[model samples]
Target: MADPDTLAPPRPRRWKRLRGGLSIQSKLLLMLLSVSLVSAVIVGAIGFTNGRQALQDSALDQLISIRELRAAEITETIDSVIRDASLQSRNLSAQTLSQTMNAAFDELQSDPLSEEQLETLETYYAEVFIPPLEESSETEYSDTAFIPDSNAGQRLQLGYTSRNLDLDEDYQELLAREDLGDGTAYSAAAAQYGDYLTHLVEEAGYEDALLLNLDGDVVYSAYKGPDLGTNVNTGPYRDTLFAQAYRDVTATNSVDAVEITDFEAWIPSLNHPTMWVVSPVGDDDGITGVMAFQLSLHRINNVMTGGEQWAEQGLGETGEVYLVGRDDLMRSNSRLLIEHPDTYAERAADGGTSPSIASRIAEIGGAVLLQPVTTRAISEAQAGRAGTMTGLDYLGGDSVIAYAPLHIEGLDWVINARIDTAEAFAPVVEFTRNVLLSLLGILLGVSLLSLVLAQAFTRPIHRLVGAVRQVAAGDLNVQVPGGARDEFGDLGNAFNDMASSLRVKQELIEEQQKENEKLLHTLMPESVANRYKKGDETISEAHENVSVVFAELLGFDDYARGLTAEQETSQLNTLMRGIDEAAAKAGVEKVRTLHGGYLASSGLVIPRVDNVRRSVEFARQAVEVLDRFNAQNGTSITLRAGIDTGTVTSGLVARTSLAYDLWGDAVNLAYRVRSVSGQPGIYVSQTVRDRTQEMVDYVEAGTVETQGQTETVWKVV
Candidate 1:
């Protein structure tokens, strides 16, 4: 480090300048990009919902169809069971059959069929079941694995755990009816019905159906014993039965009218709850009682779940669909709805108040208050009366609802099927999100690239500004080139040319102003025209004993200002050149142009025209030439010229690029002659006026005294 005494002052700190970067356009682009992304997110949600609804509706419609078909099959099987049992009864008395069944039932209670039942029954077969005889490992014919003639013969005297249900109160309610009889008749009739039901249940696929008497007692069940109750206790079935309660469920008295209802129960079908459909038994007399059959409801749902599958196929995350009930309670059968890994009965109970679905559900109760349930089939059944109903799972979030009431069997139930709406629309929603993200990424990347483009676009502008600043600072040599070949480039080229011209003009003006300064210092300024001739700077006065004349042109003002600088100078030069040539012709020294007048003499200076006449002639010729030049060039030029013979000092006024030749009393008098001149004529003082009059006519405008005057002067021409 240098010592304080040796160190110079620290260099001045320089200010940093603004430079190239993102501009207003870039900010606007980012704003528009953000807005578009937000809009896309919202639009994606709506589009996905629409697609999901379409798919779910399709699936639910098919689900309703399958439910109807399964219901029909059950009806046919129940009809078969009824027909066969009725025939068997007619062949062997119902009472006798009951005795035999009671005896077999006692043996069953004592020791139910062992696991070896298949072996025992196996021996009874004539190898008719041979192909299906092997264990499940024998899958070669698994697709054709169903047993013919219903040989899976395990049987029980009762069905589901109906005793464990709230059947006792239900039974009492049914027994309270006035149309039914006291214990004896009721029991006797019930015994016949039980025998009929027991034989039918055993003869067909054993233990697959449930029987409820006209009295509502679950007289026989597969899980609980004889005297059990109906398994109609869950919310949906309870709702169905509750709505049907306190009403007349009388069997039809006509063969044409059949009433049907289906309720899903907790009995595992393929180890899951399947639908149990009930149709009143219609005899030739009418519908005498109810017949219920079990059917798997899952078979139809697979097809409706397609869109749901598509929406979630590669999502790798669990999703669900909402199938609203006629009650508008949201529910789903998707894996996302599974509460535990193993149990269908256990679902995460997010009840009625979810935000996405709550508002729509609220409309349900509103509809109920306004009328009856309004599903297509319900409305048709009720003849367009709207009422409260339980159909579909209608939770708003990712849900679909499609319902069709089972009408062939003439029941009030609507088949409500539901699946996860997200699952249904998973493919579209994901695709949309991916597309938006891809577009957003592409646009954002392109925006960064556009920054460079913006810089390129603004380059000429930066150069233009730089050129302007340099011009302001008076750098005349600053050269700017054209670029991009647009209007801006043209403007730049024009600017360069303009700067060049201005520089040259500035130098010329400087030289002119400097010479004018020197002349003003050397001679009098009131005679401005004197600065032009070479001799006017020094010669005070000079006289050739010869004569001189003066003249003037009219309307000088309206003319002189119109000429360009170059035209004014050149025309004036031509006029002076003419005068000089005329002087040579006249053999006289023609002087006195320091005042836009002329001087010539005869006698001492030889003269062709009269000496004073030559001066007058030159002055008139100068005026004529100035007029002609103005006319030819579309400019203006005029002059007032005077000529006088007298002693006068005259010499070249030194100038870098101009001339001023003479000055003094004789020159002043010539100017005075001009000053008093009238339009389009010349005048002179008494001297030239007296001498030149012999050669030409002359006129006087006025008398005016001069600077060193001894006598009054007059315009003598």
Candidate 2:
């Protein structure tokens, strides 16, 4: 160690020393590199986040658009079918068909048919009616004959039984057969009317059409099938959708109102899904019968599948639009399953679908009338919620789905448009990857550029730092080099200009200090002004013994009203100036002046022993000054002065207005005394009279009432 009195300079840490030893160029380069890296990362992250959100929103919009388009198509198709069925139900030809059958049934029920008529009717049923039924039922024929289990199968079985084509002879005999006498005329009318209905069905693209009586008996069929003469209400097919729909339509109060039934499998028509639009038909009576039109599922599928090329309608790959009933079962065929059954099945299996759903997929090979959709989108839509969401699809895959309820009558179904999330967000992923790579490249290039810039700026920056240090040490005369005409040179010029401006401003500031001091003294007492100028917020002092003088011009208001505004202002100013001079001469501080009143105080700012005497003298002088003013201005504006001596507080009232004011009982009493009527001279309070009895002349003025108190006042003359 060296001598005990000598101390060595403390050494910095290794890292601190290293940092201190680094050149300006190295430090600047490091700082720029860090900032650039952080900025690049921040910008890239923000861009990626925004881009992803934008893409997701776009996908949701597209899904909603697709859902709306498909829903409109379905709604239009249903409306068209209903209108056609309604028109046909009310047609004259359909009425004729019903009447012809009704007349033939009435004839057979009222009277027995002759042998010749029975033979003719049998021949007609065999040749004209039985042939078509047999032809339409060709699909039901199989070498291995079997009993049917489905509603469609039961309907076929019931038709065969009613026709006596497949049932036992005893059962056929038990069924009452209608005997139409003189069948030649009835057969011709029936054939012509049946042909007309067949034409209507063919032209309308309907699978079949039937006319039923109020008893739910199919009296006429366009295809002349075995369904004829079968009572739907009590027949073997009573539980079918058609029978249920007929009962519903006939039960309605309005016969003109059309009713549609939900889609269900119709067995007589090849076990295919079918929907019916039924309208009640009536003559002069009420609803006597109902006409049912079978809507072909093929036509409906064509409308719902977007005319066979749904992909062209904005439903991208792995995207489809389908309908779901309130029961969570699919109402329409799924495009994916219809187009790629094997792949759909495999995906369904891999997705761990329910056993019932998987079995239905395997059996039906598609979603039509089979697949159950229990996804959140369908559930919410059926529950009356209409929006888009990201959730698990029917196949357990992540999907973005948009769903809405279809406003179709007699059908509680929701339409959903969906796509795989992976496909929908593919662009977002690719964009994010590209942005990150670009940011990395940009950061790399920025680091190299920052090094070059740091080196270029170091020389100028070192000169600037040295100049700043000198200026900070009060060496404003130091000049920075500005040889190169770049930003650095401009900065040097600005620094020199600023230094010169500061030196000149310093000189002006000193000169302004004296002027401010003079202005402050005029606004307040000397001590209060000094305290305020020294940055004291409140400049208030209490004086134990002080005198307050309040002087008001009597008859000033009446005199001001008679004079012009400018003349009145001039006269008031003259009177105030006189009062101010009088107060100054009497060694009292002029506290404040109002429109017609003036206040002065003594001993508050600078304590004095004869403060009461001084205040009384000031009041007397102010009254004399007003008297002189009245004489010079050719007016009679006398002065009413009040003087009081007591302990009072005085201070600057406000900083902006610079109103110096005196407060306390002495000031209040002085103000009240000055406002006394019938007294023109100076009035002195008891306290003032007591303090200045020897110095001032006072005459007893009878007790005056002021502020609810009676006080004996003395007039100074």
lDDT agreement with native, every candidate: 0.43, 0.72
- lDDT by residue (tens digit), candidate 1, 44-82: 557656765675455555444444443354345445544
Q: How high is each candidate's TM-score?
A: 0.28, 0.52
Which ranges in model 2 have alpha carbons more than 4 Å from their true place?
Answer: 1-24, 105-187, 283-285, 455-717
Candidate 1 off by > 4 Å:
1-251, 255-257, 262-717
| Per-candidate clashes, comma-separated | 69, 1
Q: lDDT tens digits, residues 1-717, model 2?
A: 587535634322322333334444555566567767888888888888888899889888988888898889899999998888777777777677777865554443344445564444455444444454444333333311222222322332233323454322342232223232335434455555666666767678887778887767676666544455567887646888778878887887446778887877664543557788888776445666788888877776777777768668777678888888877888877777777776776676666666656655765555666677888889889888899998988878999899999999888889988889998878888888898888889889888888776655444377688988988998867786543334554567678878888778877897899888888887887888878777777878888888888887788998899889999899888888888888889889888889988888888777888888888888778878877877887778888888887878888777777777789988888877765656688888887887778877778875666568888888875
Candidate 2: C-alpha lDDT: 0.72
